[model samples]
Target: MNSSQFEKIKNGKGFIAALDQSGGSTPKALAAYGVLEDAYTNDDEMFDQVHEMRTRIITSPGFDSSHILGTILFEQTMDREIEGKYTADYLADKGIVPFLKVDKGLADQKDGVQLMKPINDLDETLRRANERNIFGTKMRSVIHEANPSGIKAVVEQQFEVAKQIMAADLVPIIEPEVDIHSGEKEKCEDILHDELIQQLNALSENEYVMLKLTIPTKNNAYKELIEHPRVLRVVALSGGYSRDEANEKLKQNDGLIGSFSRALAADLRANHSGEEFDEALKSAVESIYDASVNKH
Candidate 1:
């Protein structure tokens, strides 16, 4: 995506609505959405239902005002079409940016931290995403503690992948998410801060990076990182918190927007009246937007 489009997402009042669940999480999400537990057995069955659910959200009457700046989609959802329109086109028509999740998944742990697996046939995937008009991409790796060596390894791998992504002409949301439940929360944030600085320091003077971080243990922990010359915008992920808890923590944060998944989609899913679904979705979006737009 271009700088102007990134600016639109940054400056807008909306947070990214993450519909990017894959694999077992799809069926889990369907169940959470109130689908019967026996509704689907495998990926194919679940994918069709997910497509339907997302389509419902996209076409909902009040979704246009839900303060949603963008959406991050799973590979299956990213590749799907509605009637004659690509899903990306469908969202773009509504003035929402579309981003694709590009990492294959997590790899075996190294230094007690899990890194994202390299994607398969990534060039082909990026080409298809661009062909479908996707604006950007996201990949995730985890940081489990204050271990300097582990954090450095995670940051290096993520930036290596991110450098490749930017080379392909798409904005990359580098997510090196620290586990919130881990101890030494503030210390971990400090380690992450230094590691981020080490990696971002290598970028050319004007390159723009978007980060999707775990909500800081201490408010404004990454303030300097986000203020770096190469960083465009920084957004937080829920990292397994409940919607209410995530919203509460986000309130203490500064200069960061949200790209949350569980919290953003918490109130969305099955069995509600159309009006009920829209209202719940709208409320969730607004709460997230309120937290995200907070200034330092």
Candidate 2:
């Protein structure tokens, strides 16, 4: 890892600072923001919309430039050479760190086993990303209740990937997704925490920087969810949720990175009419950040 990257991780201030650095009174905090499938679909209109949304996020009052990490899809990064400079450059120009999602997608677990295929050329991808001056890279592994053996395999893969990322001198945000498609939130938390511990144990030798949980919150079983004892330098709430739902999850996660999907798109639309959506979202972020700092 670069000296600076190591320092960032060592100090573990990246996410916390991202949330707390805004003007003392401004009710806005965002550790990181991401553009999902709509940003990757190879459509001009969609790309333009995402670009506009990115602009709004970077320019939003009290949104710290240094702390904002933007997750860019493979396709977005791929087209950068022909379409424009790498997405990293575009984001860096706006003072946002660019993160690449390296996982192919979710694994299909059936009959208590998960079949996962490796997706990217790690060395090449890291080299390209580094050349582009992107901030970091993220790879996700999934765990299912029916798949104990698969979970062990996935954890091993995550450790290997983390080693590769470290060899490339890049920060790897290790995401182990426990899908919400499962019935009970309590079951999700149990599976998630267990997988997290397993992955951490496997990567004990490596300096894995962040953990991005799929939901990180529960509607039906909030009280039963327990926080891990080790400090999670950064946590991200996955996308595919409403703004209110996103805020609720962030509140539960204690000011981790807030990764939004439909909520961000909706906010982008609201921006056109000068609505209060931005303020509302910002307030939610501020509350989480403040509460987290106070707890610390």
Candidate 3:
């Protein structure tokens, strides 16, 4: 994608829907709609699954080649060696931009201190991945505490990682994910707003670097309205909802970008069943996009 197209994706209200089961019993049609399938397994069976996903996405009518972005898990892609490069090439051939998820899973924390070590040799890994011509990469870190010191530390870490990623010529999807599972909607909103402010401040301090997307939760409409445009180029919806519910939330948010988890897995299966699933997903996506536009 060109810089303009990348900016459009970054700034526009789009969807970053997932395809999480590339290695399992996933149906083909679902992969077409920007599914981030688990194509990282080394087993021959997993390779077959990844192939099926690739075939399905490339051929599916419901999948918008221009709008789709595919993600590969670091573990899966790294283990498969040449498979990683092949996967990137395959997605490019299908007109889909490929992204790598580069977090070391969730960190183990203790008494407000993260016990896990930072990702080592990140620069080297990114250099190799770039050689394969992957389009983008995402990295996530948790802010365990809502206090000022913790928030400052999280922002520092995020900015440092983002700088490193950008230096490698990779668009970073900086995710300071505040776990929604912990608090009520009101509390969640407060935490999210606080985090968003801090993240933007850090990005600004770094001369407002270019980013691929920012995946954040929807807490309050006013907060989103105020903060969305100021932070990252694109505002991405977080995971943890069904397809129907996710569609509904996207509609409600209007111009905001939508991302998913189980919804993608379910939608992929739905696509294999035939026309019903295709129509529903397409209609829903288009409708949300339209609604978001209309609101503005």
Candidate 4:
């Protein structure tokens, strides 16, 4: 692990950029960026378009470390280049830590939840990430209900995979998101909070993990997890909330930072001119940054 990068994440004043939209979510991400489905006829073309979007965001003057601590990247994005440097290298140059999304998407929902599918060639992926100067990895699973068994299974699986990532000397962001729209959203978060603490308690004394959770219905709902010695940082995903709504809720949480995807890129459009794009991105980044650093 890079010590300097680790310190930055441990005490950084800004939010993480979730630019890791996967193959399954790329089309929707592109569509929101003003690149409609008709623009890309195949998967490769689709990815190319999304790559361009990512490249634009990474290279923008507005996307720097001053108000952005790190970026979470798709595996494909990590493998690709921005400007003359690899994506991770490019981020490092801007003083930003880069994390790779390592999950192979989610499996079909069972027991009212969805767990991550088996990650094929995970060792190879970790090796590649280390070679590229990547600082960490992020993987996700979802809980749609307050079922104790299902939530327990999700948390266990996340920690299990996270250990493999940690063994590679990279920090892992274990995301067991309780769906923001679940009928029992508060109950789901309460269960998830307990499950997470249990898993954190079981970690070896020297081991550390990061968490990415849905912004809870109640303020400071995961305060214990945020303060755990075993936890390095606790970040909140935007889920389906608009940027404004997400920011409002985020300010009420004292220790959490934003790891927003849709909300971070909400104001940018594919058809925007150079200056327009930069200004829009700057606006988005500034708002999210404020919400991250200025707690209620």
**Best candidate (score: TM-score):** 4
In candidate 1, list every pair of residues with a backbone clash.
Answer: 33-270
- Writing each residue's lDDT as its tens digit, candidate 1 over 139-206 gives 88887767889888888888887887788788788888888888866787788888889889899975
lDDT tens digits, residue span 177-206, model 4: 888889999999998888898889999987
Better of 1 and 3 by TM-score: 1
Tens digit per residue, CA lDDT, model 3, 208-293: 33232223344224344334443444444444555555555555544455545454444444234567656655654454344334
CA lDDT of each candidate? 0.81, 0.50, 0.51, 0.95
* Number of colliding residue pairs in each model: 1, 0, 8, 0
TM-score of 1: 0.94
Error of 4 at 224 (Å): 0.8
The better candidate by TM-score, 3 or 4, is: 4
Give the alpha carbon lDDT tens digit for every residue of 1-296 in model 2. Answer: 34543454434322321111112111121212334443344455444544444445444654444443344444344335422565556555655455666655556665343434575676777787677776556766555554555655665676677678767766676666665565544565665566657656544544555666666544323222223323234555444566565555655544354544334434333224333546744654454344333332
- Give the C-alpha lDDT of model 3: 0.51
Stretches > 4 Å off in candidate 4: none
Give the poorly placed runs of model 2, Cα more than 4 Å off: 2-49, 52-56, 59-63, 66-95, 111-116, 142-146, 204-206, 215-232, 254-257, 270-296
- Error (Å) of candidate 3 at residue 183 is 2.4
Location of the lowest summed lDDT over 10 successive residues in candidate 3: 206-215
C-alpha lDDT of residue 145 in model 2: 57
**Per-residue error at 288 for model 1, in Å?**
0.7
